[model samples]
Target: MAILDNTSLQLPKENPGAEDFLPLLGTDHVELYVGNAKQAAHYYISAWGFQPLAYAGLETGLKDKVSYVLQQDKIRLVLTSPLRSGGPINKHIDAHGDGVKAIALWVDDATKSHHETTKRGADSYLEPKTLKDKDGEVVLSGIHTYGETVHIFVERSNYNGVFLPGYISWNPHYKAPEVGLKYIDHMVGNVGWNEMDKWCRFYEKVMGFAQLISFDDKDISTEYTALMSKVMSNGNGRIKFPINEPAEGRKKSQIEEYIEFYNGAGVQHMAMATDNIIETVTALKNRGIEFLTVPASYYEDVLDRVGEIDEDLMPLKELSILIDRDDEGYLLQIFTKPILDRPTMFIEIIQRKGAKSFGKGNFKALFEAIEREQESRGTL
Candidate 1:
């Protein structure tokens, strides 16, 4: 009996990399720890246009946590929350608010990644272990990241389980249609003050990642707050992780608030790629997802800056989407407000016309917009 008989998710396509930084096999799934899995799952499906994929909870025999899996194209999110009070999930909720807990990576070999990173001083969160059920078996290992965040290495080459051993196929009565979200472009992590380089070095030495892009205070600074960032990519460029550290500026930053609530460095936002930002965002907005509102004035000069675009500028202006152009091409990007109550994590919706670069031009405007939100929250 195969785990993925015929009605299962597809396996990741393997991309071979050198021993260094094991050019990320790909994103397996993103697991977010929310205060309520059921509500969060609803929010994702209703607002973000993600369709329910799989589930594990009391019915499946899991006593401690409930996880709802959602998917759009290759991007999958596992929303997990504690079913009871006074547990690790509660502690995490109280400390960090609702945020990403695990950025699981698809790998060919779990034990090798675990041993290599552990030997290089990575804190072990879970020892290399195998999980098996009637469907199939999966080998998994994990390591602690900033705060309570974790990087789970999933070796499913030999496993065909629905999701994992415990998770059964989720055939929901209601289904939300996909909104053209293809895959994760990059996942950004926010570290504490003056710690971006430390983690960058960790990835460089431990995982053999190279700095693909870097932004100093000058580049990312706004009127009230500022932060620095460096993008790290595996050899194949399939997996890109950007590390962010708050810079000493006039006022407190969004990154600082994340560190305060999250209690340390953790994932701030997961950038999802869409082939059509206008269509996707429009669908998302109609579905009830509220994006961060920027002023119309920001659009006055967008065309002049990014040159001509295929999208109608009027609609983009109405939606407050920011556009940026690089040598290769252009991109449209917008962000949502903190989906949780604590002002911690947010979502970024981006569409690449041809450019592979993060929106450097929009950083200042985006940060200023964020500062305004911080002002409203009395965080600054």
Candidate 2:
């Protein structure tokens, strides 16, 4: 379990001259189109420790759809479902099951963000629109990204509502305890073959992101499967998106399986940050969240490669968490089995000691673990 040489880990130097025209404040909220918003919201609340925040439906004057907003610290998730038999929300759910629809970004000016991105050749998903309530007013704009997913620019400086203009405060009596899950660390999207560079370029030229790191098939492959990835980050380093595409593998790679089941390129998983992964994961497991597990051999020499850390090795190894290190520091991460029925989307729980890089050193062990799951599903 020797770690790869530091030279093999590719962390590209940031371009000093790179200008960020469309600056983002942070992730506003992730909206998912699900078959049943009520049940989906309950799952997130009970299993993932998200508390109820707001709601929108007929009671809120929304005729065509309903939405339930949940929150945990800085992370917000909006679960939406269609009210009618046929519409865009229903269509999206039919095609992709329960998956992320919008990666909403907080910004200062929604109009300016839309103009900047559209002028740079990004497809418009939502024209700049202003919504108002007694609380205040908020501006929103959006642009299409890889697959059917979209990036929504939300300008809420003028608003003081619970969630948004249309949504009312949803004070649910059953509140789950917080799991210490903080803000979103990053979101990874899986694209089609030969499409990784295209989306990466879109993030670079349109969104003004810089390449933080890159992984070829050689860096992230097992004997049976392979994939390529490149991480893109915003100017302030608050947002990160790592795009992955399947490579030629002996069998089906996870990216290929995701693209196939999701019906196209889409968000694969979201990595959520935590101050104490041990406590958070323990709570999540007790609440019925299952994580992928690597063999016992993975931990036999993990400390040898990752070197010294503040936390004890026994707990991390017992929980099947993977560790990796870079020049900055080391990070602990573990992946969940696909949460949806299609085996398309999942979640990653990550705790960074100081490391800025993804776990390149854990690639083999992680992918082998994924391959094991694929074998069980007969998709490998």
Candidate 3:
């Protein structure tokens, strides 16, 4: 139950003598099970500024489902939908509307990664399989994590196709301006009540991650709600997951609402990294992206708490962007309203100057903003 003040912020440390059995290169792609892949793909292309990369559907010889791949820099998103009723994709979409299904991780050897994690008590989601085409071959395997979300291990060193073996190059005439999004910074998961530590241990013992930092109800509470979080990171620092659970409070917390609507533990938000947050946020806003906003009074004393920063205070305040400083440096970030209809999944735009820590200084303002949104929806 340590409070993370600006002066006391610390980065995650690797576990002592922990062997890196599951060596992951980075995130390959994030797949979402939507209701319609074509329209969803158009939304991502027109609104989020993701470029079309590849496709696989009836034309590609698949009958049950269709997938559309989009890319922006190093970030890739795969949107899949069921072509027929009564399939798993339809069931997943029925349960959780347009949510992430697989968080694919890039690895050097998918077979070895699956063997190591499965031997460490992980539930097997997909066995080791090799997909081959004219370009090359790609090996893949998977393991179940919290809830229905699965982590797919992708080894594509031998593959040079557009995306995978079955997918073909998708070149569409419609294009949008790039938004300067670099890569996935981190993904946050919301578990049921008092289940944060269970998944934290799952990441530590099963996937070889170490505790980064922790925040309790005392550290992350408002007048009406509270939540606790513990961050876990891989040995190479390429992946980070912060597990959150609801704490006792005066009313419903955001984590509780997410769990109730999502029907189980799932990813709450994905934080995307940008080198120029001001420009990126501006483009996003121009494209009709709505963000959560705090009161003007919150900015009055923000500089006094965070000290001087490189960016001008007026622009950050104008866009309602939040700023926080760790021992290393400061970071600029902002959260979008739930993109989906269920108030479940959202996106975070962040730019790191040198800071490695999450925005502990801006928790109160951010949560208060979230509470305002919840109240409007009558869920708070």
Candidate 4:
């Protein structure tokens, strides 16, 4: 499948200001530090239907680490593992387990992005470095964000090779058919207590983002758990990040549990956009992907709550999908159970019809579903 075209899409009007200095094309890739890249690659391939795209390791002359790049449309995932015992990759895995390390962004000029961000008070993670191969050259730079997560600016307009200079095109005999997933809709981060606004401001000041929306604990809480979130988006709305923090609740909040298990702040979920949520989610479900399911009662008066939508109510009710509406339009969304054993990271499948809002209307039902899972796991 080809990448989904988002050029014509329009978000809810919130004129933050003109974004000029740090222009982001879109999300290039999300890199995760894992214990075993090979097994992780297989899991994603078999379960999530990601096609192996590129690889870098001992065969590619990388002695310290190995990375497997998987792609499905515009969504790319780089699973990296340490080859040796004492490298920085190993240290990150030890500290955070298999979690996101980098949210690579596609930019026009890596050097200019780095300079502009650093000048705006961002901490440098990596200086601009150009990697060249026979195909072409790619310029890269990085800046530190919340926790140990880094945003790597990738300028690959000049490069034509497979991925970076070091990675080679990976074509295994075994390849999984792609799911209907098109691209990343948004990535949510779980920060510590009272840290959502801090990171939200960081995105605004350093990366030229705007506050899309803010949700307090009252807006997104069940009886047991609570958290606050603030959505931040890039100038052109190509990238969005909702920073969340644990809030005072009767029991442990989901963000607090993520912080405890992940050992610190990190990405909670990546909301993937699909043209048809019914087909995409059906494919995932058949492939053994477990989703957080709401009760059947949620379907009884759903249409009365959100008003008329294009989709039939039966399939949605059968599939346990959730729906929400805003002034713009309605959106259909579903969340997968934690993909890893640690219960830290997960994925959300979202189909936005004309709505720009982040399913705020479905918070109570969704969080209640999550709380049920937490109860089963004894985490809440």
For each candidate in turn, the TM-score is 0.92, 0.96, 0.95, 0.96
lDDT of 2 by residue, 29-134 (tens): 9999999999999999999999899999999889999999998988999999999999999899999999999999988889999999999999999999999999
Q: Tell me model 4's lDDT, rounded to 2 decimals.
A: 0.90
For every candidate in turn, the CA RMSD to the true structure comes to: 3.5, 6.3, 6.0, 2.3
Off by over 4 Å in 4: 1-15
lDDT of each: 0.83, 0.90, 0.90, 0.90
Q: Which 10 consecutive residues of model 2 have the lowest summed lDDT?
A: 1-10
> For residues 181-215, could you state the per-residue lDDT of candidate 1 as single tens digits?
88899999998877899998888778777788899
Residue 309 lDDT in candidate 3: 89
Top lDDT model: 2
lDDT of 3 by residue, 1-380 (tens): 11111121133434443345677667889999999899999988888899999999999999999999999988899999999999789989888888999999988889999999999999999999999999999899999999899999998888777889999989999989889988999999999987999999999888888888899999899999999999888876778899999999999999999998998999999999999999999999999999999888878999998899888988888899999999989999999999999989999999999898999999999999999999999999
TM-score of 2: 0.96
Q: Candidate 3: which stretches are off by over 4 Å? A: 1-18
Residue 33 local lDDT, model 3: 96
Poorest lDDT segment (10 consecutive residues) of candidate 1: 1-10
Ordered by lDDT, highest first, the candidates read: 2, 3, 4, 1
Error of 4 at 147 (Å): 0.7
Error at 24, model 4, angstroms: 0.6
lDDT of 2: 0.90
Evaluation by TM-score, superior candidate among 1 and 4: 4
Global lDDT for candidate 3? Answer: 0.90
